[model samples]
Target: MLFAAGCLAILLGITHSILGEVLVFKRLRENSIIPNLTGHKFNLRQIRILWVSWHLVTLFGWALGILLFLLADVNNAPATLITQLKQVIAIAMCGGATLVLLGTKAKHPGWIVLLSIAILVWFT
Candidate 1:
């Protein structure tokens, strides 16, 4: 279950990035819908920053998933390390879920998978 949760987290990260690119950013780009943070050329800087920030979430999730996967495969790991991993992963997942839920008013599906991952890690 822990491995599966890790896999799901990875999958979710990939899906989130792809969907955001195709469904959100593409349309925004096509329509020139990015908000202007500065008066002139500096507005492009805002777009670039926003783009990087958007993808950073995906990268962070990927890192967490990779850590979970690697830890799941560890043999004879110390109980303290396992306990710490469980706590960290579970807390991160729950925090991410809460953020998504509140940030998007539950419109985004990421919260569901995130909460599911947290539950799996908790039970494992």
Candidate 2:
């Protein structure tokens, strides 16, 4: 479970960075896909900054997930603390996924897979 979660976290981190920094930001800067899809005028600099911030947040989330997995594997903490940590991770991941799916209507497969893995790891 820990291994699976760790690997998924790393994969998601990479995917998020690529999608946000390269794909989405590029489109926004070029005034191409995003303006058409969103139907909103965006200042290139502001949009770029926003996406960069989002990318950083995603990377931070992945780092936290990895840290949690390592802490669980080491078994160096009290049982209660570990249990609490797992619950927090589960809630955070699931809630984030839910927001992405419903709020944004995102078609990204990576998010769906991340949500599935998060639920599975939480249970197992």
Candidate 3:
């Protein structure tokens, strides 16, 4: 169940990224959807639901990965390498979340933040 949940979360990030890429972004920026954050009053409250959802997914995935790594058999060089790789991936995800929370996007850091958290959790 937990493994499935982790996969679902990674899928969610992909979905969200695609949707944001297509739907949320302004046509002018081409790939970037961010608006004028410097002048406008960014509404954190409006986007809170998405932010939290992503956060939970990330946290759970990360925690699970860490737990599994600690418990998994690492007798072989490959197994140890895989565990190390997952930890690195998890750390990257955490880094992504940090970027978002640090105000990467005032409008839709939702997808970015959530996906970051999820990916980090899964690999970690």
Candidate 4:
């Protein structure tokens, strides 16, 4: 459970700090500033660069996280339970990923996934 919890913490942290910035602050930073405006002269481009770099790094982090979570879950779970739970998790995860990938960030989709995770946690 500790390992799974650790993975969840890292996952949530990356989702919030890294991906959330991309999803939230990216637009704000884009629209908030006027291009070619000079501060220290380095400020404008720096924010853009930071945004891009952050997104890129977070993409990598997410990729790593998917693999890590998969491995961690597999490693921690007993074989019988793993088989029983695999299909449910796959459906929930893949369906959730598909919905999120389709450019829908509505609360419904995320909440559904959250509820499914809750069920999984409860059952397992």
- lDDT (tens digit, per residue) of candidate 3 on 1-124: 5445555655665676556536643332323233322213335443343443444455555555544444453454777657765665566556556535543344446547656665856755
Model 3, runs deviating above 4 Å? 26-90, 97-124
* lDDT tens digits, residue span 44-92, model 4: 4554444434443444444444545555565456765455445445544
Which structure among the candidates has the greatest lDDT? 1
Clashing residue pairs in candidate 2 (N, C-alpha, C atoms within 3 angstroms): none
User: Which run of 10 residues does model 3 get worst, by summed lDDT?
Assistant: 30-39
- Per-residue error at 83 for model 2, in Å? 18
lDDT at 108, model 3: 44
Ranking by lDDT: 1, 2, 3, 4
| Local distance difference test values of all predictions, in order | 0.68, 0.60, 0.50, 0.47
What are the models' TM-scores? Answer: 0.49, 0.44, 0.37, 0.35
Best of the two (2, 3) by TM-score: 2
Question: With candidate 1 superimposed using the best TM-score fit, by how many Å does residue 99's alpha carbon deviate from the native?
Answer: 23
How much is the lDDT of residue 118 in candidate 1? 88
Model 2 lDDT tens row, 5-66: 77777788888877775756665534443322331665544453455346546755785766
TM-score of model 2 relative to the true fold?
Answer: 0.44
Of the two candidates 1 and 3, the one with more favorable lDDT, higher being better, is: 1
Q: Give candidate 4's root-mean-square deviation (CA, Å).
A: 10.3
Q: In candidate 3, which residue pairs clash?
A: 58-117, 58-118, 61-121, 62-121
